[model samples]
Target: MNRKQEETETPSKYMNQMIRQQQKQLLRLLRKAGVMPDERIEVRDSELLIGLFSQIRRLPEFAEDKKKAAMLMHAMDTIFKFPVSRATVQKIYYRNKDF
Candidate 1:
């Protein structure tokens, strides 16, 4: 492809790779938190993962559930590290009020 086509494709390719990496990290975190089966990591939708994090953060035992809390924070940090808009993050925070 020409330079213009390459430029357009590059960002998409990078985004896809980043998304895959993020998904893997999320799966790891879920497994570590014992929220998912340790034998296999399923590829779940981002929204589902986000919802799980939300619930984790809202748990009454969050203060005492160190492992799960740490995993939830790590997942949130990883997600925020991506190039998402501030508004998007705000929306997430607002939707998950406990976070």
Candidate 2:
């Protein structure tokens, strides 16, 4: 390709500026919800929490109570910290001791 075409193929400064603007827009949308600042989200009732805890108890994979507690704690942290991701979940699962 010619020099002019090559320059156009590369992302221009204006393109970078536009990308930043879009990212800011997304952040603004998230801020409108109560989720961005790591606020404690209240559940409906004690029963709900109990149900959740019970469901966790039924999972067959955790070999010990400590590991189960660690995994559950990691899951809760992930649910609050940012958007959920499988890789992030796995990372938290393995890194539970550090938390």
Q: What is the C-alpha lDDT of each candidate?
A: 0.61, 0.55
lDDT for position 67 in model 1: 66
Candidate 2, 39-85: lDDT as tens digits: 64544343344345445644576545666866675556435433445
Residue 1 in candidate 2, Cα distance off native in Å: 63
Q: Model 2, poorest ten-residue lDDT window?
A: 90-99
Candidate 1 error regions (>4 Å): 1-44, 63-71, 79-83, 93-99
Question: What is the C-alpha lDDT profile of model 1 across 1-99, one tens digit per residue?
Answer: 458868876556667799879989998999899998655233335445555676766678875676666676665755444344535543563374542
The lDDT leader among the candidates is 1
lDDT of 2: 0.55
Q: List the residue pairs that clash in candidate 1.
A: none
lDDT of candidate 2 at residue 49, scale 0 to 100: 45
Q: How close is candidate 2 to the true structure, as a TM-score?
A: 0.30
